[model samples]
Target: MLNEGLSARSPKPKAKMNRLYPLLLLVAAAMFAYAPFMILAAPYESTMGLIQKIFYFHAPVAMTMFVSAFVCGIASAIFLFGGRLGADRVAMAAAELTSILGLIVLVTGPMWARKAWGVWWQWDARLTSTLVLWLIFQAYLLLRRFGGPGSDRLAAGVALFGMANVPFVYWSVNVWRTVHPTTTVVPSLQPGMRGPFWYCFLAFVLLYVSVLGVRTRLEKRRAELEALYLAVEE
Candidate 1:
């Protein structure tokens, strides 16, 4: 009865997701295709000029990274507290994406900084705290990959710490008055710049969601295969 109940319920979510994937893929593809032209048409900043264009990509991807980190942390919390294998799979996928997107933010930040700040890197509160958040998620992935049994729980605990810093990262520039621009920059964007800036933001977010779904499905398949192998061994 338990086996029958599990089998009956499991396919519904997968079936729904299967139908949505194509739509998501199409929309994400269309947005990405059109994004460059939109970006090129926008005016450059007076101070940084052309170099500031990287902000279109950098800010959006960084926002996606922040969202990904929270997703991973929330999923991790669910897995840790509820013992849900499905949530663990999601947490794993989100952690990997966070790490990947965080890398983009880190690299682009330096490139933008070199142009704007006249340095490749700075030890400001914002930069330093962002680095710490990225490192914590990286460590979670490493622990998941290399640590012994029960590592997911340990990694989940670590992820909670990582998620805790999200607020600090955003507020750091304001509180510390660093070389980096404050979070208020986004809201205060000029009329022409705000349109393309937010357009790219939506595009990156959709891309992240589509990629995360695919990655989570892969994790689910791996978990099922592992369980089947263990059943056979028994």
Candidate 2:
């Protein structure tokens, strides 16, 4: 009976592909191709030279990870309070994508740090908080896998709680002194670095949205597949 109840709650299958989806795919591919070149050519060339270009990818990925976590928290809250299954699915999708991007940032950050700071790792506040956030999402995914009947609710709670660290991570450099430089360059609306920086930032944001959309669609499909599998068992 519990199995039946669980299966009943799963979502229905999605429809066939549409025209807009293809356009999104094209845009995603274009951005992926364009981002690396812009990063390499950006004007704020560090003493480390071209290698410092990794900063473009690292910082933007970190920013998008925070955005994803915030969105996940909001969706999780809606799911818990309103019992909205779509919201729950969105939260799950966001969490999964955030985890992936967080891993990318973690890897790229160390590379950039090694070049810029002459160390592969450090115990700075920003680094520590970012790692904490990554671990929380890792734990969230694990709990979902083994949590049994209340998995959705448990994961939703984790998502909401884990996201409380987002602000701390963002402000960590300001909140406390650290070896990591406060800003990549001096702050200005029209700074010398603004051109390539903004272009790279936009490319990354577009890439993130594309990847998130694809992952969410896959999650929805997986939910439908599980539902079908249960129906067959019955």
Candidate 3:
């Protein structure tokens, strides 16, 4: 009965998504396909030169990662206080994506820093805080996997902390004297580079939205199956 009612209520929204999912995927694909060329064409920074070009990928994806953390944090908040399982599923998916994107940011960051800062690792404020944020999401995932009963609430709470850290991470460069570049980098971009940077940023966002939709839908089905099993046991 639960499964039947759930299935009945879901088709309309799913159908509407079906109409838009393909288009979203297509646009993201088109942007990603041409991103390389745009990055190559942009004028190199006077200082960082070829290495600075990585900013096109690194910065935009970092922006997307931060947004994903917020999505997870907000969804987790709703789930924790509202007792909504759908929000929990979204939080889970967002947590997963955040971790994935964080890896990219962390990796590309050191790549750029290696050339710019002459070091692959730094214990500075920005880097450490970013690592902490990534670890928080990873811990959330681990909790969801191994945390027996009532883990969702606990994971949601943890996700909230990760969300709280994002602003600190973003501002750490300026708040303290860190070797990391300041936030001014984006706003100060040269016109030649600004176009590609924004192009890549939009692409990452569309890609995030597309993936989040698919992951959230899958999580819903998995939740349904779990519910059905519980019903059988009862």
Worst 10 residues of 1 by lDDT: 178-187
Query: Residues 199-223, candidate 3, lDDT per residue (tens digit)?
Result: 9999999999989988987888887
**Candidate 1 positional error at 50, Å:** 1.3
lDDT tens digits, residue span 1-234, model 2: 335445544344433332345566688678778766665555765466777667666777887888888888999999999998768888888888889988998888777777766788755555667787888889888999998988999899988888776676657644664445543432243354566666666766766666666666667667767777777777
How do all models score by TM-score? Answer: 0.88, 0.79, 0.87
Give per-model CA RMSD.
3.3, 4.5, 3.0
Ordered list by TM-score, greatest first: 1, 3, 2
The C-alpha lDDT values of all candidates are 0.80, 0.72, 0.84
- Summing lDDT over every window of 10 consecutive residues in candidate 2, give the lowest-scoring window: 10-19
Identify the superior model by lDDT, candidate 1 or candidate 3: 3
What's the lDDT for residue 1 in model 3?
Answer: 46
Candidate 1, 32: how far from true, in Å?
A: 0.8
Clash pairs (backbone) in predicted model 3: none
